[model samples]
Target: MAMFVHLTSAANAPGVRRSGIRAASHGQGSARGVYCFPVLPSYTLTHQWLRELARFGSRGGLVAVHVRLDDAQEVLVGRYAERARMAQVVVSAAEAVRRIAALEDPRGWEVFVPRAIRPREVHRVRTAPQVTGWRYLPDAHGARPCTCFGCRVRGGYGARRLRERLPHPLDGPPPPVRVLLAQVAAGDPGDAAALREALHWFSMRRRGPLDRLAGLATHPDPGVREDLVWAVAGWSTPGVTELLDGLADDPDADVREAVEAARDPIS
Candidate 1:
């Protein structure tokens, strides 16, 4: 049998003891399973997922549930990111341990059993240090965080504070609407860039003095009109619907396409 450790909330200890570890899908895929790491020699490595799992606001503290599976049992093994891409390789339980143990740095590596673990397979549950292992990513301590919209989920724990501390260059907060309008009116060589930036900002915040920008609908630049479509697409303002209707027939093919995309973003 190959030994592995699964980290989970201490609050679920009673249930786990009663019914083993239930298999569940992480996201929208067929990769439903219990995620565990091999029982490595290093105690720290064996419970490396403790801190990261805590970040998800697991009820109470965390515990390491030791489990044993047949060496011939099939499992998926890969780095956390590779699993999302369905790039994990199918391997025997014993091979999974051997591969990860041989790696010099197996911080984000994981083994996934595609079904629920039975109570007989569970060896024991023990307390794990809540602070053990890394958060965010392995070795991410003291490193500058990427504050891009995709990387930093809005309203997440410490998300706002982290962005405020280390804001990205292009993804940082935009200038005031008045400041953006001034740059647009100047009509300098940089006006197009400024206008595009302003539109991008407005897209995220649909509540703005959009009337001031109504004139841009016919602005000589077709790109500006296309961007304006995107900016007001989600707004429920009185005239926004009419504005989008008019832009739908724009002479420029790109502007028409933008209107379509804005109306049905899923496509």
Candidate 2:
């Protein structure tokens, strides 16, 4: 939720009716509150307000503030309405936009000041609701099984998404690899053989004269070393297996585990 703080001209009469904007326009305070109008081009006002709101919300700030002149017209009012709907603020939209525009903008106020504030909410954990009705509905009646993550996300199926993202022992970034990884790690051999074939192709490509990332895979950093192990583990080529077999004795346990996990042979 977003909040707003509104600042009106100090000279304006205290009894101003916000809904009676026309009355405010005819009143005596117009000359004093000129600073309350937006300094940006009329068209850019919306974009500017959006950016400011996002910046403020990202930081732990409670309220979004804008200053409004006593006589701001309909255009300003509409802009405020839009912003007010999206953000939680202490002041009305018209007032906040007007005030922010009136203030002297420091260099990089948008970038620097907001970066110091952190979001109030952190690490939101989403759990999927239990499926009580899918079983009662007819299967294969409406939507075909979606292979992409979009449907799963829409249904709030977090566990399935996690299972889908994990890498298989033999496949890399391809669909076949993703499927193999989705299979139980200990219980399948036909799927394992298919994974072996995919790896075999990957191995040939990685070892061919065109390979560029091979050098980085052998870098001294532990992360790099472990990535290399997982990357090479998915290939079926003798060259890749040979390298992993040699690296089984690597000082890093992560790298060793990756090497051993990828050593499955087709019977």
Candidate 3:
């Protein structure tokens, strides 16, 4: 599977690079090894990144910055960009001015950076449609708060920071699919984390039960689908192969990426 990042002046540049996404994280990436790549864009792009990040229990967000870009900069992406695990955009100087003027979101914040950082790597700025992240498994911590790396870092204020409040996330891995789905539907802020844990747990089950859960791929929740896609990525089962192949055109872009990322290089 190819890990791609979008690069440009403001990280939205037209430069698309095929590179491996490093798993190194300043904080607990997730109980499930959810990783994130900085991407470019405000609305549509942010959701895609967050959803992808959320699947692995890693958290991501978008922040808007005012910056100038070279003429060759890009403002949009093709299918590959949509399939990217991480994407960035660099609007040309002209496009930046136009977007800034045409901006419709009243709450967008401006980030003032030092002169050195501002001009050098404007693409590295972390932008978000919203901010959210989940921590390690809850059971491992042995506390109601699950004081694992995840809870300690973000103080559970990640996805919760969005205007649409989430109830909270799950506490630990579930033994099966129904319980997993219920935990997800509960709408916990840690829902993503729980999904990660469940993914980790499900991968070890016997073939019979594991295949049963795979059939639930039709689940409507994007969160569940995100979790499902990443959960089955590395498994060696006939059903898993078909499950990924069938998701090629999933309505959700992130789901499709998960499927693509799960494919074996030689397959």
Top of the candidates by lDDT: 1
Q: How big is the positional error of residue 187 in model 2, measured in Å on the Cα after superposition?
A: 42
Per-residue lDDT for 81-170 in model 1, tens only? 896688999999999999999999999999999998999999999888887897778988788778874456545789778888998887
Using lDDT as the measure, what is the rank order of every candidate, best first?
A: 1, 3, 2
Summing lDDT over every window of 10 consecutive residues in candidate 3, give the lowest-scoring window.
Answer: 106-115
Write the residue-wise lDDT of candidate 2 on 137-252 in tens digits.
12423754443321222224563454367533443334443443333132323244443443343332333321333443444565655655655654444566556666788888
Candidate 3 residue-wise lDDT, 1-267, digit = tens: 111122112232212112212121112222111122222354443233332233332212223332333434433221222323333233443443344435453122111111122233333333443333222321233444432222333323563343134223442223667775555455444455665566655543433345645644776666667777766665656677677777877898777766755551110
Candidate 1 residue runs with Cα over 4 Å from true position:
148-160, 167-267
Candidate 3 global CA lDDT score: 0.39
Superposed by TM-score, candidate 3 places the C-alpha of residue 224 at a distance from the truth, in angstroms, of 0.6
Give the local distance difference test score of model 1: 0.80
What TM-score quantifies how close candidate 2 is to the native fold?
A: 0.24
Worst 10 residues of 1 by lDDT: 258-267
Q: Rate the local accuracy (lDDT) of all candidates.
A: 0.80, 0.34, 0.39
Model 2 CA deviation exceeding 4 Å by range: 1-211, 265-267
How close is every model to the real structure, measured as TM-score?
0.60, 0.24, 0.31
